[model samples]
Target: MFEEDYKRRFVFGSDYGTSDYKYGPITLGERPAVIENRGYLPERSMVSKILGVEKDIVVGKDVAYFLESGADLSSRMIYPMRDGVVAKSDPTAWRVIKELTKFSLEEFKPSGFGFKGYYIVASLSAIAPRYMYENLINIYDEISRETGLIHASTIIPQPLAVAIAHKELSCVVVESGHGNTQVAPISRAPIRDAIVALNRGGSEANAITAEVLKDSGYGDLAKEESLVRRVKENLGLLPLNLDEAINYAKRNPEHVRAIYQVPGTRIKIDLAEYSWTRFLIGEYVFDPNHEIFQSYFKRGMPRPSDTRVGDITFYGMLDMAETIIRAVERCPVELQPHLYSHIILSGGNFMWRPVSTMKGIAVDSQTKLQHMLRDKGLENVNVRLSPEPQYAVWRGCIVYGYAIPANYRWEWEKMEGWVYHTK
Candidate 1:
């Protein structure tokens, strides 16, 4: 049997990227809140638009909503995690956490039964460094002192938790949230090889796409940051057929291109006019002429093989591939095959097929010296792209509380802090 008593836990995951702070709550077995219009009410509201229930039930409460008061508050809720590190390094973030805990209890309606415990599922990345671990503990302790809710601990790595939730082992986990593209090799039990790229993610791509569109000088349309993001999501990759794409950019700039429209603002562009800029943006991944490839190819150029596609020319693709390969190279030799077998990918950038498609080359480039060994046709080298790449980290953290064994609770508390214990 399991602990069956109703215990209110505040489950939250955050993507504190370079530009934004996003958070949401998670529930283990029951609805946590009766979500209302832009705010949650203690009392049940109308029927759930999706679940067809009389009360609008949300499985987990949201810290963003609580901090922003469901968009009702004037002060913006800011996430302090940046580059997979908490930026504030101060205690304010903890205050927000405590408030979120209070809100979660309100939503879950923990009985007049005195508060039993408060738990949180934080990112394993948050615990990677010793200093980060200590800061997190400080934050947690502060929250406990303010809120008085007891019982708290952190679970496994974010990617590992997600793997547990998906019941997927021997897979690649990628989380591209705000700042970094985090890759982890996951088996059914734990993470094997974890690698993170500092300068690659959705935000960078968004900026590149936006700048490209702006340089094209069409209308104010596609140049808008929001519009660029949408367009990049929709049709941002370099065309498989460069000639065809070039023609498309030239002749039908309006249809092939995009524009953004707000209530009062709008912009459009004829991408053909800014083809050079587009190509520059594409170089972030597909630049075959990059220093590394150019050096290698120049040394010994081979005639095009029938099975091989032409060498990649997109700069972005090349960088992504090279980075992954480099990281793979940095992995211990004994763990290489195991890590490759469990390539788990997450991140908003991974949403782009062009980015994911280069994984083989990226891995291959680094292990090129082991060409014979790699070419031996290892079928187990798999790249597992998470279904919802953006939410994986947060969702994983939410379930960590349930997935990990309880034996490590002390370490978790020492690193994170005691949960909010209300006397």
Candidate 2:
């Protein structure tokens, strides 16, 4: 009872996503603390020395204080994970990750009786290599020894964590973020060998949005990535049928037309006559092979090309349904049906909702994926958008840490269990 009570209070969950990091202790309830997964390295000033400001790297929202103007800020800011894997030799990236971890731990460090340290469960990308695991564990070890903020730590795949959060042990988890998408089958544990990697995600949606902006005479604004993303999120509509939705938008211009006012600024982007281009953003994410996209490709908008990462080949052009099908088929024949019956979509990339005004023309990710799969003759398909997709991984981490026995030592072969002892 004592162990269970202690675990419930002290277990910490960290989700290191491509665009953001969500972290907190078990007591945080449903949501976790989020910060852009980037860090800023500040150049020491003489005034800072006099003030006794000694930290080398600044993380989370506090990075705003150390940020430089224009070009310098961009150069100093480091985003550790691109395709969910950090390069082994990027010392600066590693330092940022370490600082971010320590920063979060320290921020929530409990102060009271019987509180020695936290037992942390961190969720990483499914395709993260052995070196990533090693480096992360080493960082945790160093932090534990130095600060006594971590009692034990373990890393689980983001997809598996999603499955745990949703309580779907025998399911397929499609985790999409800014840089890439990972479709992994989880029977009892994540079937790493059967994972399907995709080099397309929210960035792909943003790419099409930029093109739409350029074609619609917002060429100057299209150059800004952040503005492009905001435009994509607000105006992008996932269509039931790409061609059908395009026709609907072209006809009922008033209903589908988008006017997004940049928050806190007078800038309002109105896709007046070019509102039909909105469907292009969502369609490009699901299936970019449509001939309409060829014009954009011809016009010098770089296509999402296939890339190889270790043993996995992240496909660029394959539709989402095809990608999921390919991943599920890699598993045993008997489990395929079970896997198909419970499909969970988790992450910021899958958060788009269908507009009520668009009706049959636009559909959410769940409906769109279901239609795409049913068209391919997989009748047993069931897809669900994870609840509060942003918090799923972190919640799973908390549940994982709370349930696992403390005596179970880290097993390198299976890559599950806790590290009671660290360097």
Candidate 3:
């Protein structure tokens, strides 16, 4: 009991995002350290000969070294949370997740004062299954056994973490990351039954951007996913009206035309006549049902299909507006209006900025969501982007860790409070 009391002083937050793992103790001010949520399992020969290390897995920045060693990246690299959830049977994915957790804790493990462990608050997908939670708990327990890195831990939904960061007890959180989008309604506590998961996000935007690249004669460059993403970030435009935006681009092709130089390379891509297709990238994310996107699907691009991942049915073709409505309607009617009024957008996917030069033509995520809601008869809707969408979950973890009472025991039914892993 005394040891558990001592552990409360060092609180840590870990956000297991699809693209990156954001983690650090509460002392890590404002933001947490981010590492790509990936790992590389070094070949047995290399581990024994070159590195002289017995560890089988390499994580975070070290993964890049293995990549540079000319290993077949496809076989060696592992992205555990690529789809935001790991299956029970996938040992490789589980290993990556375990290594990531260990890597994070070790980085900040204080050396002095006979450190006991850390009180950790970890965030996961809102629709994560019981098995995923169990898997994570087991992983943390293993780390504790090996290094005494965890005193206790608790897991909360990513959307709930975002809500906690903003002290929004009653708001709808639309968190879109690289792999998927989660729309969750909260009224003090998250309405788990009402949560909606979408199999679309920034990655989908990247896909459309790649398609645009192929159409613009940069077919070879499109194969490089990272390069295609950079081009998309630099050139993609969210249109106020998709049809009008395309027509405007056609009329003033010179204004829309752009040349993007790869940051560290001399290669420059000139989207001359094909610049108009840039709007399609953003449009596809909000509403893949748009007629324009059909061409890409027909031309071999994989269509986003509805999938069921452990009780949560992810809608692939639903637009942002319809998704919000679908999720909100599941809650009590009395709470629906309040949720609409405080619609909070949180995630990397919503961190888009309006191109000021484009003026009336360009739109930011908030404006786009508002317009979509209004079209669906949602009047006086207030959709706002999270102040720090990318770090909101991490921040919430910090706050949750600090606020939740150390004595409060975990209740499976409520799914809140600290779960004491080490006595």
Top candidate (lDDT): 2
lDDT tens digits by residue: candidate 3, 1-423:
664456456889999988889999987899999998888887777545776766689998877666644337667777787657877889989999989999999999898886778999999998788888888888888888899999889998899899999889999999999889999999988898999989998889999998888888889888765687788889888887799889989998988888899877899999888999988878888899988888889999989989998789999999989999999999999999999999999988886778777776778989999998999898979998998899999999988888777898888888878877777
lDDT of each: 0.45, 0.90, 0.87
TM-score for every candidate vs. truth? 0.60, 0.95, 0.95
Candidate 2: residue 231 Cα off by (Å): 1.8
- lDDT of candidate 2 vs native? 0.90
Candidate 2 scores a C-alpha RMSD against the true structure in Å of 1.9
Give the per-residue lDDT of model 1 (tens digit) for 110-178.
Answer: 456655545655554422455655555565566566554434545345556556556566444555554
- Per-residue CA lDDT of model 2 for 1-423, tens digit only, reads 776677777999999998899999988888999998888877788866787867788898888777666567567778888878888999999999999999999999877777778999999998888899999999998999989999889999999899999998799999999889999999888988899999998888999999999888999888766789999999998999999998898789999987999998998999999999999999898899999999999999888889998888999999999999999999999999999989999999998889888887888999999999999999989999997888899988988998888777799998999986432
Q: After superposition, how far is residue 414 of candidate 1 from its true place, in Å?
A: 10
Order of candidate numbers by lDDT, starting with the best: 2, 3, 1
- Superior candidate under lDDT, 1 versus 2: 2
Model 1 lDDT, residue 37, Cα: 13
- How much does candidate 3 score in TM-score? 0.95
Clashing pairs in 3: none
